[model samples]
Target: MQYTMPTIFLASGSPRRLELLKNLDLNVRQKKLPFTEKINRRLSSNKIAEEISYYKAKQAITHIKNDEILLTADTIVCKGNEILVKPRNQNEAFEFLTKLSDTSHSVITGVTMGIPNKLSTFSAETKVYFEPLSKQEIHYYVEKYKPLDKAGAYGIQEWIGWSKIFKIEGSFSNVMGLPTHMIHNYLVNWQKS
Candidate 1:
């Protein structure tokens, strides 16, 4: 059979993901799905991200054409087994960042690539170490960054990430929201087959 390159459909509202894909110079289009991540506490941290991506992919299936593949993802922060998602308000954002202050946490980005007959899912995990943040600093970030839209009340590419993050032990882009290296490898190899 002849292989035809599938048009890429990005099913996420995150500007970070959009920029990452665009930066890679991939032929991609953005269409956000109704995917507010609903966490199942029973699952592991990495599994939570992967499962949410699967749900997002399923929701986006209707928008995909026969010659297109839908890409969806969910990112979460894990401090031990506790999962921190997007905050609902500034106060919550305050609390989330405070908890992450001066500690090591895992940022997991789960991804799904859905085609006509198959769905492939995987997750990338990055270990991020944060410096001790003062109350004023946390408040300042919440006020200035408006981090309610981001997972764990923070964006690794934003001010807090630049200032407060001390170290990262894995894919930097994964902490930003998408794992570009992994995604690129998949796109390259997937296109080949």
Candidate 2:
């Protein structure tokens, strides 16, 4: 079978994901999905991530052209069985960081890609370890970085990433909210199909 690149659309509001996609040199359009953003409700982290990605992809389908290939993704941070989503305020950010410090957590990103009738879904997981953080460091990070928009109260590509992240055990991009290598391979294979 022969493959041809289709017009690409990214169904997410994450600037990090956008930047990563741009780094790949693919001309992709961006579309934010309409859905509620709430974590720690009652669903499993993996289930929530997949469901959210699916919902986002479904929403994007309504607005996309038939020829445009739509891609949607959702990322979640999991510590043991608990899901740590984006903080709603500074206090939550503080608490989240304190709990994550010196511990290993998994970052899961679920990705969906489709064009009208054809749809595929996959997810990537990365384990991130943070060095033990000081109270002063946590306070400074929260106040200076304002990480309310990021899951686990920090960005792995930001100042915190440079100073705090001790190690990572998977695609680094996944920790940043998108799995570039997996996404690229999926896109390349999808185009072939």
Which has the greatest lDDT? 1
Q: Each candidate's root-mean-square deviation in Å?
A: 2.7, 2.5
Candidate 1 has an lDDT of: 0.88
Clashes of 1: 0
lDDT of each: 0.88, 0.84
Give one digit per residue, the lDDT tens place, for model 2 in 1-193: 7434666788777788889988877777887766675453577676778778877777778778766778888888888987888899999999999999998999999888887767788888999999999999999999999999888889998888999898899999888888899877887887576
lDDT of each residue in 1-193, candidate 1, tens digit only: 8433457899888888999987777778888767666888888888989999998888788888776778998899988878888899999999999999999999999999968568899999999999999999999999999999888999988899999998999999998889999888887788778
Identify the candidate with maximal TM-score: 1
* Candidate 1 positional error at 155, Å: 0.9
- How well does each candidate superpose onto the true structure, as a TM-score? 0.94, 0.91
- The 10-residue segment with the lowest total lDDT in model 2: 32-41
Note the residue pairs that clash in candidate 2.
none
